[model samples]
Target: MPMTEEQLKGILRRFDTNGDGKISRRELRVGLRNLGLRFAGFRARRSLRHADANGDGVISEEEMNELAKYVSKWGISII
Candidate 1:
């Protein structure tokens, strides 16, 4: 099943070390790693590439849902 925005956000909160209300590449790296995913760094870069619309090098709150969708498309659950 695809991951939901809520689920994704929950994961973000769990891993948002800097508490900056955004998902930086580093944060996503840690998050995906906690998910037991291999190639987490690569996945983070890919997700940022897919979701960072403004090219700001981070996934803002506004881009979270998009990020969730991209991750779901990768068959990775938010949990």
Candidate 2:
């Protein structure tokens, strides 16, 4: 199923630590940990970079939004 606005908003809320409507690498890792996926040290940095946009070395809100679509496409929901 496609990503619902509410679901996407929830995901953003989970990562938007500063309430600034944007997510940094630290925030993304927090969200990943909440989802039961954890990495450490260099691995964490690499993972975040892999998802980053603009090569600034952090996943921004735009990247997070794009990622939400992928997450919803792969996630299974019963209803």
C-alpha lDDT score of every prediction, in listed order:
0.82, 0.59
Q: Please identify model 1 stretches exceeding 4 Å from their true place.
A: 1-3, 77-79
Could you give candidate 1's per-residue lDDT for residues 1-79 as a string of tens digits? 5555697667766666887887899999999998898999999999899999999998888887788788776666654
Question: Which candidate leads the pack in lDDT?
Answer: 1
Provide TM-scores for the models: 0.83, 0.53
**TM-score quality measure for candidate 1:** 0.83
Instruction: Give the residue spans of candidate 2 off by over 4 A.
Output: 1-6, 38-47, 70-79
lDDT of 2 at 7: 75
Give one clash count per candidate, in the order shown. Answer: 0, 0
For residue 75, give model 1's deviation from the true position in Å. 1.8
